[model samples]
Target chain A: MPTSDDKPTPNTDEPVTGAEADKAAEIAAAKAKAAEEVPPKNPWEEKPVAPTHSDAMDDDDVVALEGLVVSADLFTGAVTATVDAEKILDVCRFLKEERGYAFLVDLTAIDWPEREEGRFDLIYWLHRHEDSKRVRLRAILGEDQTIESVESIWGAANWMEREVYDLFGVIFENHPGLERILTWEGFNGHPLRKDFPVEGIDTGAAIYPDVYPPGGGPIVPEEGEGA
Target chain B: MMNGPERPLFDVEEMEISFGPQHPATHGVLRLQMKLDGERIVEAKPIIGYLHRGTEKLFETMTFPACIPHTDRLDYVNAAHNNQGFCITMEKLLGISIPPRAAYLRMILAELQRLASHLVWLATHAVDIGAITPFFYTFRERDEILDLFEEYCGARLTLNTMKIGGLPFELPQGWLDRCAKFVDAFPAHIDEYETLLTTNRIWKRRTIGVGVISPEDAINMGLTGPPLRGSGVEWDIRKVFPYDRYDEVEFDVPIGTNCDTYDRYLVRIEEMRQSIRILRQCLEKLPEGPIMAKAPKVLRSPEGMVYGSVESPKGELGYFIVATEKGTTPYRCRVRPPSFVNLQALPQMVKGSLVADMMAVIGTLDIVLGEIDR
Candidate 1:
């Protein structure tokens, strides 16, 4: 074997030789091109942008109902029109007949007791299958205000209106057989109202009155009162 | 004409009867105040609320993340979809997109849940219709699904496995392999179930044309999921509003030609196969990434209302959440339960059918009183 010093060695002073320098430059250029051509980030990696509510005053359906719509808001690609409570039936009929919103997706109420305009906001979600578009019609109601029932327009609203009536105590004017749905007929107080306690009140409909006391379960004995 | 007896042979008076608050065929505490003309049902009025736990009211008092468990209780058999619907609505309100891995995981879990839910429906429905054998067959598969669920999360029935921004944990060791094994074996099991019921004469006679609701009537009544598909309306929330990687998955929405109990049954069975197809695709194209998004420790929602829906096994399970600015808890959370809306059409479905056929109609509707009364 040749001695270590006798072997032919390249110069250590220069950083890179001509051929090696060419290879390094090619690798760097390839890396830069690859970085430029990197795939787009996934939906989750991107920051989510919240949808802002825009004025839907120029929407075709909102424009059609000239004075009926109090205000129309478009948020997250869904249109919500605040319509007059008095002309709800007319507007519902117009939507059903003219606009083909045959499906009443949901009907519910949100209680805003402190609002000066109204105490309850009734939301009606309607779906048109032609384009899979949904529109919401919100009508404000006072504490004792009654709105017209869209039972005849869409049969699906019959039970939904009754549920609102039962839970929020908002009466539907023309709802046939509008009885309490989610509560007993004689149960006192609307359970969904803001004033209702979360722990629940005594409904006085005890199953075993003898074993458990009314409004309270089996009484726990006091520290000194029981053995 | 043979004159057997004088002065009216038998008195035929319309009778009113309460069907169930505890009957097995009614599923849960659904009591039907029915008017009957001899053996035929004149009218059936559904009296619900016995199972009502004030779920919506309870939602108002809890933090956004804490409310996930309560949603599981809404449809006990289909808890995963309920969690998904609530989380989707919450995510929309907070404007937080989940990671790719989380989305794929959610799809897998949800499809598994759909399989489980439909299995329960089939078991209960078959038992209700007097085919007790299919119950035994279906529950075997349902137990394996529940086992997978128990392996993933600690709970089986009420699996609160989802979080707002992402999943709570990454997949355990060999979890994906086990899930793949199950997915591969599930199609054969479905075939086994079909062999037992699909072509059986008794199943056909009991289900075919028993509960017929026209397509227009089904849409007007707001029927969804299998019920809507059974009426030949090709409307699926998955196809219409693709959420959580559903758009990337390739599957067909099985529609029915004739709107009947049999068609609905066929639709659900085919839907099970489509779910398998989706699972295969999701498994093949599952991307590797961080499971959780960069979310704040305390999630605060913007002030507004958002309505987000998912294609649940039952139907379009929607959660309409109303949030105040920077509020941790929802102002008003409304659950548009599919069973509640589907159960509303019971009166129309069972009218003029025999008393025995009422069980078939109820089974076909697949109304869960837990959801109906929620």
Candidate 2:
């Protein structure tokens, strides 16, 4: 699907006339013909381009990494590539080794409980010192899918992957020490999951237990645990 | 009754110790699970999240504007950059361009916050290594910066002064004069700090060549700010990816040669000087115009993703925001906190070093547990 970064479609506020539609089509065809004949100009010769928010991958880079990507979109100047969950390791390796994206800026996931494609979208942001540009890679995973770890590619991914596991409950295949970094051991639920309660879950660790009731009360905990 | 080979008095094995979720020198609520072999650190694993309040998860439930206050809580010491990163991401998502005046004002506040943050780092780092007088001198200058923040925004520490489109308010009357005054005298105070710790024998012994990280290793480990710069990487986001009016300002990105704790200290001190340079230029070229853009009060961003980062005091503070179609709140907001990523190198840096040097390494990393845990 064309995302927000694509050129917006024509406005339909007014009823279209057949003559006007024909004219618009003719103008578009002429413009396309003119573009085909003209040679591309050197971007370096033009005024220095201002920095933009869109981090979308170039069309050539997407085509070069074809089989690995499931889908790709650009929005608000940021490019996002969606790859298969199982291929994440190889894809990240390619980006790191061959592409010189040495710095793993961040590794995070977004939980979408309602999405049919998958329950979570794991995102990786990488940067290169040479070019000073960032590329965001994403992979959609099913509710039970286990992702291949990128810790081997970038050591920085070690703690980041653990944090993702702790908050989103998405398992990683080869993380060194796959444990909670934010919440402690024996925490009841994955806090960042959409299903988790906003007010908080009944973890049975509430303070001032006598003042509130159980199941999200001001003070109460589970019946047996509190006293 | 010793043996022929001189029998040991005690059993020789790696001893384990927990270094704070309580100790003062650990900075905040950071706990390090450390293994020691006769005062030499076998390994150190930094266990964070003692200050975690689920800030990223909280961003999903709050509106775009409401999220600014929450960002302030992430890196509490250098809160303006947090606000700036979030606001920049939101502005990118919403396709709003801030006015020139607002951008310049943001640079001023961010630079001032940098000075204040480095002061805190210097004060604490010095105290950790046995120097205490510098703490008083640094905090004195830091207080004046906080006063400027209070005059610009009502609050000092959690200055939620930035909005998505631009700053929430313009500079208060006479605020620029006071800020200029603060920036002018700040360098002299930094010199005072350098005099105390830069040449002192004890300070040199505690910091020089301690926690050395090679430049190549620093890049691969994803270090930024002074830690990465201290390793001679010379990668500052302001120069590489200038945000706000940083592109217009004249300043140098100070880097170190030795890649040691002393180098990091020198880098931070020079950074304070550079911030003063930037602040002076900004104050001189202060523009006149609207402080905010003409944006809709109820922001509904189109479906897309944008990552915005700034050269925050700690490192590159970035916000990766994913917005759904017509979404009021961000779909997923990921904060790439510099401290969290930089602190990953602690184990690598502290290995084979003396147990006492661990405190010096931790202080040199200049971590704020709030940012690490968030």
Q: What is the TM-score of each candidate against the true structure?
A: 0.91, 0.87
Task: Give the Å error, residue B60, model 2.
Answer: 1.2
Candidate 1 Cα errors over 4 Å, as ranges: A1-43, A46-48, A215-227, B3-9
Q: Which residue runs of candidate 2 sit more than 4 Å off their true CA positions?
A: A1-58, A206-227, B1-3
Q: Clash pairs of candidate 2? A: A54-A77, A54-A78, A55-A77, A55-A78, A55-A79, A56-A78, A56-A79, A212-A219, A212-A220
The candidate scoring highest on TM-score is 1
* Residue B30 alpha-carbon offset, candidate 2, angstroms: 0.7
Candidate 1 residue B71 C-alpha distance from true site, Å? 0.5
Q: DockQ, in order, for the candidates? A: 0.51, 0.22
Q: For candidate 2, lDDT tens digit of each residue in B1-374? A: 65588767788899999989999999899999999998999989988888989888899899999999999999999999999999887776676777788888999999899999999999999888889999999899889989888877889999999987787787778888888778778778888888898899999999899999998788778899999999998999999988787888888989999999999999999999998999999989988877887777688877777888988999999998878888999888889999999999999999999998998999999999999998
lDDT per residue (tens digit) for residues B182-296 in model 1? 8999999999989989999999999898889999999889999999999999989999999888999999999998899999999999999999999998888888888887667
| Pairs with steric clashes in candidate 1 | none
The fraction of reference A/B contacts recovered in model 1 reads 0.65
Worst lDDT run of 10 residues, candidate 2 chain B, spans: B1-10
TM-score (C-alpha) between model 1 and the true structure: 0.91
* Residue A25 shift from truth in candidate 1, angstroms: 16
**For model 1, what is the error of residue B106's alpha carbon versus the real structure, in angstroms, after optimal superposition?**
0.7
Candidate 1 chain B minimal-lDDT segment of 10 residues:
B1-10
Total backbone collisions, model 2: 9
